[model samples]
Structures are given as structure tokens and as C-alpha cells.
Target: MSTTPSDASRPSLIRWPERLGYGVGDTACCLFWAIVSSYLNLFYTDVFGLAPAALAWLLLITRIWDAAFDPVVGMIADRTSTRWGKFRPWILWSIVPFMVAEIALFTTPHLGPTGKLVYAYITYSVVMLIYSAINVPYGALLGVITDDSAERTTLASYRFIGAFVGNFIVQGILLYLVQALGRGNNRLGYTLAVTILACGSGLLLFYVFLSTNERIQPPQAENSVRRDLRDLLGNRPWLVLFAMGAISLVYLTLRQVASVYYVTYYMGDRGLIPAFLLAGTAFSILGAMLAPWMARRVGCKKRTFILLTLWAAACNAATALAGPRDLVLIFGTQMLGSMPLAAIFPLMGSMFADTADYGELKFGRRATGLIFAGSTFSQKTGGAIGAAIVNLVLSSVGYVANAKQSASVLGGLRHLMGTLPAAGGLLVAGLALFYEIDTKREREIGAAIAARVRSVAAGRPSDS
Candidate 1:
């Protein structure tokens, strides 16, 4: 098994239009996710009249379900083969069911508390499973797209840009659209929001299906699910990265859910929620835009560690210091802190691909699906933990559902929103400190691998 490619090896860089198309689809999917993550709790507590503890249980259980299924889905994807390629077929197959599940999640039927809980469970579980189906493969597709390290970074940038745009649309514009659509009826408004999100998600999936091409066509490794899992566990770097992913998921989930309470209760300007979210998202886009250039200079892992540390410190300080009167300071801090997060996504994706390569090199089996599944599992688990924490914190602080809170209660909510997430961010940065891969090292590995592949193809004996 050679690692390097010959001089005549086909170039792996994707065309720009294809990249843009993939970006659009990814953005749309993220838009739906952002809406769900940012607003679902609010919708349940305020709109659906579900108690926080009850909602927490529902979320927790569903996430547990999701966590259980993620690895299985990964194993399935690894074993999958089709004319369209392993990943794309999953993406294509998931479109309709994914849309239906998403719409179901947001549909606010006039149901009793028991009915609502049932609905939440059924819809959330289905959506999560379908989401895992598409998302795992979608993430794994990055490795399949190209073997060129720099180009992979470029693709990651485009992907992050798409994610930023999706976040912007969901957090920045979706609420306003809901208001416009429903006017006076909150239920009708949210329903409209769900419809728009579902349609957008479907459209984006179609775009991804049409635009992107899989280049690194490794023959599907014929392995049992147990063997694939064992192979993934054997990859030390991949295991480390999976640990990092868990930390990141916690940080991201806290950030997403807390921001809503911070704006609504602490800052006393529920209207500014969109502005606050947009500011951070916009900064994230800027950060992603700068990643390629920065990675080339300082290497992806080191740059990520440095920036995330700075972000953690700034965010924590901002949370601890900001009061109701200090709106500008609070918002400014969040925006500045979010920039580093933007840079992290693409770099993280590149690292996962690198781990995929390392796995192939060491194990002589490509378990891209399994690797990507670890990422999905971490993120979902994080979201689950965050949801549980948010609910527990709110309940502990005497957060009464759908009622005006006392000043002290509001202050407590603010702290949970700001300080807790800041702390999580700090933990995430510390965890990332152990990431040892650097761009120079990655390039060297890529070059060596390419050379080995080339030698083998040329019928010359080569050492790899």
C-alpha cells in the first residue's frame, strides 16, 4: 500500500463553482440547525408552555437516542457503496425525510403538555437520526474531495463561509420573518418559520447533490461494523481529535442556547437578539476568511490554539463584567470573541481529514464514515449536555416559565448565559492545547504520501 501520488497524478482541487454550490447547501442546512438550536428552547418554554425540567428531559432523552445511533450510522455509511459515491447517496436520500422531520419539529400543533412531549420526542428523534445520516457523510466527504492539503483548507474555508451565512440567515433574519408571517399569532409565525427553514434546507441539499464531485475514489473497504469501530479506536490521533470535538461541542451548545436567555432576560432587549447573534456570526465569517492565509503562515493547529485561548479569555471577561447597563461592552466582547470560533471550524475539518489520512496510513483501511461519526457524536452529546445544563441552571435560579422574572433571577440568568459559556470556552481552548499537528508537518506528510503513490503507479518499488 503506497501513500504518494506520481507526477502525473490527477489534481484534486475542486472547481470554484462546485465549492460555492456546496457552500450554499451547507449554509442552508446550518440555517435550519441554527434556528433549532437557538430558538427551540424558547419556543418550548414560552410558546408551547412546556416546563423547563420537562423540556430538558425530552431533549436529554432524544440526544441519548441520537448518540446511540451516530456510530451505527457511521458504520452503515462506511459499508455503503453506490454509483453516486458513499457520502452523496446518503445526502440525496436524506433530503425528503430530513425536510419532513425539520418541519415536524417546528410545527406547533394545539396539543396538551403530554401530547407536546410526545410530539417533541417523535420529531426530534427522527430529525436527529436523519440529520446524522446526511451530516456524517457530508463531513466525511471532505476527505474524499481532495488529497491536496492546501486545497482541503480552501474547501474548509468555503464550508465555514457557508456555515456562517446559514447562521446569519437563521439568527439574523428568521425571527423577523416569523414575526412578519404570523403578525399576531405566535403559533402561526413559528409555523411559517419552520416552513421556510424546511424549504431552504431541501433546496440546499439539491445544490450539494448537483455541484460537488468525489475525487479520492478509494474502493470501499469490506469490513464488518465491529472491525470498522475497532479500526477507528486504533487511530490514536483520531481519538485525540474526537476528545477535542467533545470539548468543542460543549462550548458551542452552551454558546448557542445561552445567548437567547442573555438577550431576553439579562440585556433586557429581546429585540436585539438578532443583532447580537449577527454581530458574532459576521465576525466568525471574517475569521474564516482569514484562516487560509493564517494557516499557511502559522499552521492550522497552532493558530487554532492561540486564537481559541484569546477568545476564551475575552469572552469570560466580557461575561463577568457586563451588566444590564453595559450593552455595548457586552455585545462588543461577544463579537470579538466569536471571530476565533469562526477560524476553528475549517481548521478542525482539515484536522479530521488529516486524521483520516493517518488512519489509512496506519490501518490500511479507510474508515472516513467512522471518523466523521465520532465528530457527530461529540457535537450531539455536547448539545445534549448544554441543553440539560441550561435547563437545570434555569430551574435552580427560579426561572419561571413564560413569566416576567425578578431582577435577581434575571441577573442569575445572565450569569448562566455569559459566565458559564465563557468558562466552557476557556476549557475548550485548554483542551485544544494538546493538538500537535501543524501545517508544515501536514504538508510534509502529504508530499511523502503523494510521492509514494506516484512511485507505485510507475511500477517502481518504493518505501513509504
Candidate 2:
């Protein structure tokens, strides 16, 4: 275990620059995420003309690998030692490889369908694996950054503001960037755009390495993966978050991955894709900014998350009735849907961090990396299921790329945005109801952990 004098004291205010810089890392992570979440399925579809079923298999398999791999990475990260700290060092180590893999994932190789399918598996796996290596640790960084529960929530807000900024950059500009850079070659445009953005993402991660410090650690230097797993499974708050994370993402991914096809095919305007996505991104930023205030005002992060999740889903469901030319209805629902969707992320982050505290206080052990990684596992699994559902629906509906669709096919797209998300949203809200930690409980946990860490620090003077 490691603890500075400051670590012995919970609620120490982190300076603005460091907090901002830490948040900036999420911006980079989210930038890449925007690409994958928003466009990867489209890329796979157009790249080789694979059946949507094949593409669904591709997404499902790769994401399954990605989800399962998070816990292993988290375990490794928990045991890691370095001058830079356990989590930040992973960012430094993985950033370059991550960029390389990102570019590879976007590059379109000339090949037959079978060859292309194989290539997709290889490249997607590499990119997703590299992403897990960096991202799991980065999420874990929140738990170690500060012990202050309120400050942790505040920092989570800033982190997601950076996230929405990343989404803004990609949503508002990537298509235009691809067009301008491609000179009318869609393949070339994606390659060039991804390459440019990959470099920027790498630089932002490097800034995180330079700007952040790890201040809190467990009371023991020893680690037990079995214990970590056992503790995680037994932790009620973690279990609720785990379920909520999965179902919420299943809903979110279905809509996000469906949006491109919906806009181009159902809405009858390809140009509307960028605008539609941007409206969601812009409002997501508003949601992220409002989350902390709302949580405080609502008297608990858990309650705020429930309200936002339900509202977001209802808004998404309402979009089902919109006609092809109902621009107001479509965009209005998008803005309404995205705001609450965005707000939930920071609250989720804070709640997960609180769960880590809850585990240590209860179990006499700490593994921040493993706990956050479990959260990631839930989210990635949900996203995989959601994406798989989208692909299966498209395949079943006789969707032909860049072609006019039947009424039923268009109806399928509308139901994806509406019906599927509503069910998932209700499940997520219901799961959230079981989350026991309020702001009051979170503070009590933090203070108790601090006192124990202080006792351990006194016994081991060298740690101070």
C-alpha cells in the first residue's frame, strides 16, 4: 500500500489544472469511442459488402473478447509498480500501439469477402484489446486521484465534459473531415481522418501521464485475484452498477449504432446524419455539465441517475412516431434524449468510485483497477449485445446498403430507436433502485477508509 500525508486526509481539494488535465484524457478516449460507437458498423458494412449477419458476428465476438479482457488488464494494473503510478503508466505504454491499431481498424484492405472478414476480426480485436489496456486503467485512475466523494463527483463531471468535447469534435466534424481529406474517396477519407485523430488522442493521453498523480492505495501490498473477484461479486452496490451499466449501454448502443443507417435510409437525407449526431453531442455536453448540480440538488447521485436514465429513454422512445420529414420531432427527441443520457455518465462514474470505497471498507482490501474494470466489463458486454441486436435486426429486415428500403424495414429502424431503448431504460432504472449509496453513505465510507489508511500509514512510516 502507498499513502502520502495527503492520502491520509480525505477531501483534499485537487487543483484545477490537474483536474482539467485528468479530464482531458477522457476527451481523447471518448474521441476514439465516438468513432467506434458511431461509425464502425457502417465501415464494416461498406468496406467489404459483408452481410449484416457477418458484421454482427464480427462485432459480437470482438466485443466479447474485449469485455472479458478488461478484468485481466485490471488485475495486471492493480499489481503494477512504476514511477508514474500504476494507471498512468498503462496510458503511456499503450497510447502509441492504440493509435496504430485505430488506423489499422479504419483502413480498408482490398480483398475478397472471406479475406476481408478475417482481416476485420484481426484488426478489430487488436484495436479493442489496446483500447481495453488503456481505458480500464484510466477509469480506475478516478478512484485513486482523490478520496473526497464530492470532489470525486466534481472531477467525474469535468472528465465527462471532456468526453462530450471529444464526441463534439468527432460528431460535428469527422464526416466533413473524411470528405475533405478523402477527395471523394470514402475509404481514403476515413483512413486520413482516423490517422489525424489518432495522433491527437495519443497526445492527450500523454498529457494525462504528465498532469496526474495517484494519491490513494490499499492497506496491503499483496494482491489476490480470487479475493478481488469474490469481493466484487459480494458487493451489492457494485452488483447493481454492473447490471445498470450493461443494460443502459445495450439501449444506448442500439440507438447510436442505428442512428447512421436510420438517418440515411429511413430519414431520406444523408446530410442529416452529421446534424443529427451533433445535436445529440451538444446536448450531451449540457447534460454532463448539469449532472453534478442535479445530483446535489436531487440529494443523491443514485436518484439523479434514475431520473435521467428514465427521461432519456422516454425521449428516445418518442422518436418512433416521427415521420420522415419531421425534423423538429426527430431532432427535438434527439436533444431531449441525449441530455439525460449524457448526465448519467458522470453520476455512474462517481457511483462506481463510491462502490470501490464501499468494497474496501467492508472487505479490508482494495483493488480500484479491478472494480472499475468490472464496470467496464458490464458496459462493453451491454454495448456488444446492443450492437448485435442492431445488426441482427438490419439483416433480418432485408436492409441493402445505399438502397431504398421497404416500409417494414423503415419501421424496424424506428422501433430500434423507440421500443428497444424504452425496455432497456426501464431495466436500468429498476436496477438503479437497488444502489444503496447516497451522498451521506458515500461520505461516511470515505472518512472511514481515510482513518484506516491513516492507521496503516502510521504503522508503516516509510509509506508516508
TM-score of each: 0.93, 0.96
Q: What number of backbone clashes does candidate 2 have, counting pairs of residues 3 or more apart or in separate chains?
A: 0
**Candidate 1, run of 10 with poorest lDDT:** 1-10
Candidate 2, residues 4-28: lDDT per residue as tens digits? 6665543565999989988899899
Please list the Cα RMSD from the true structure of every candidate, rounded to 1 decimal place: 2.3, 2.4
**Predicted model with the maximum lDDT:** 2
| List of clashing residue pairs for candidate 1 | 3-449, 4-449, 4-450, 4-451, 4-452, 4-453, 4-454, 5-450, 5-454, 6-454
Query: What is the number of backbone collisions in each predicted candidate, taken in the order shown?
Result: 10, 0
Q: Write the per-residue lDDT of candidate 1 for residues 11-32, one digit (tens) a residue.
A: 5557899888767766867967
Q: Looking at candidate 2, what is the lDDT of residue 289?
A: 90
Where's the lowest-lDDT run of ten residues in candidate 2? 1-10
How much is the lDDT of residue 59 in candidate 2? 90
